[model samples]
Target: MSLAFLLLTMGLVCLVAGGALALNVRGCAHALERKAAGNAELAMHARGELGQPQLVMSARLYRCLGTVFVLCGIVLTPYGFLELA
Candidate 1:
């Protein structure tokens, strides 16, 4: 039961964090778009280096990752139940 409770708590934490991250990404969509465009331009101008634009943040990537995390948390939270019967 203790372990189950621990899992449940961790799952809830993940869910909250993932939801917050997803919402944050949505709130900053415009800024992310501009940053992405700048990164693309920088990448196009790279001559000898193919990794010049490694500092850019991808909104789609974060959104998908967050969604996956939220899903995992949802699954985990339910699995924390001590008994189904």
Candidate 2:
């Protein structure tokens, strides 16, 4: 029972972190898009390389965090059962 509760708490924490990270990454992309649109030189530079790449990297990182959270939940679930046994 204690293990179950612990696992649940950890799972919730992971889910929250994943969600926050995902939202932050999306917000960053939206902000960048808006910034790029306002100035032609900025837009051209954004299109050239660096700007889009960073956004993509951040998005991938969030995706990885979400994946890790899910995996941790799965792992903890079985471990919780073992603890009960």
Candidate 3:
């Protein structure tokens, strides 16, 4: 009804979404890790056996998104709760 309540709802939604996203990302990262291990030579040959840039980037993006969503939830929840009270 109120702004605070809305924020609280939004924040909770973000938290749930973020958590789900993070889990999916984690799975992807795990898969990439396995893939990279399989083709380490070619995947990292250009970079002197460093790592696969695409996989790394994908994992990073997911991680960053997850963090952002969770942080959003963390930042919004308290304000919403306090204001609602």
Candidate 4:
């Protein structure tokens, strides 16, 4: 009983976290992109046409991770219910 309840709670937490991240996906991506763009401009100014690598966090990474978390939560919630059954 406790195990099932714990699983359900964990699942709910994951779902909520993933949902929040998904909601901010666009804004996060845009901010990262802007930062990268600024870095790129600086690189071009200093590197004389040679491009320097910028560490940019891609929006896709957040989306994929959030998707994974949501999927885990969805699977877990069902299993938690099944445990009660």
Candidates in order, TM-scores: namely 0.58, 0.42, 0.57, 0.61
**Backbone clashes, each candidate:** 0, 0, 0, 0
On a 0 to 1 TM-score scale, where does candidate 3 land against the true structure?
0.57
Give the per-residue lDDT of model 1 (tens digit) for 13-83.
Answer: 87987776667654654466567878786766775555545545577666676788788889888888743
| Local distance difference test, each candidate | 0.71, 0.59, 0.73, 0.76
Candidate 4: Cα lDDT at 23: 64
Question: Per-residue lDDT of 13-71 in model 2, one digit per residue for the tens?
Answer: 66565555546655753454444455655655767854432233344564566667767
Candidate 2 Cα lDDT to native = 0.59
- Comparing 2 and 3 by lDDT, which wins? 3
Instruction: List where candidate 1 sits over 4 angstroms from the true fold.
Output: 25-52, 55-57, 83-85
Q: Rank all candidate structures by their TM-score, best first, as comma-separated numbers.
A: 4, 1, 3, 2
The residue ranges of model 4 lying beyond 4 angstroms of the native Cα positions read 25-53
lDDT of 3 by residue, 1-85 (tens): 4999899998999898776666765486456555665665575676676654544446556656877898899999999988978
The residue pairs that clash in candidate 2, if any, are none
Cα error of candidate 2 at position 25, Å: 13
Lowest-scoring 10 consecutive residues by lDDT in candidate 4?
24-33
Question: Which 10-residue window of candidate 1 scores lowest in summed lDDT?
Answer: 48-57
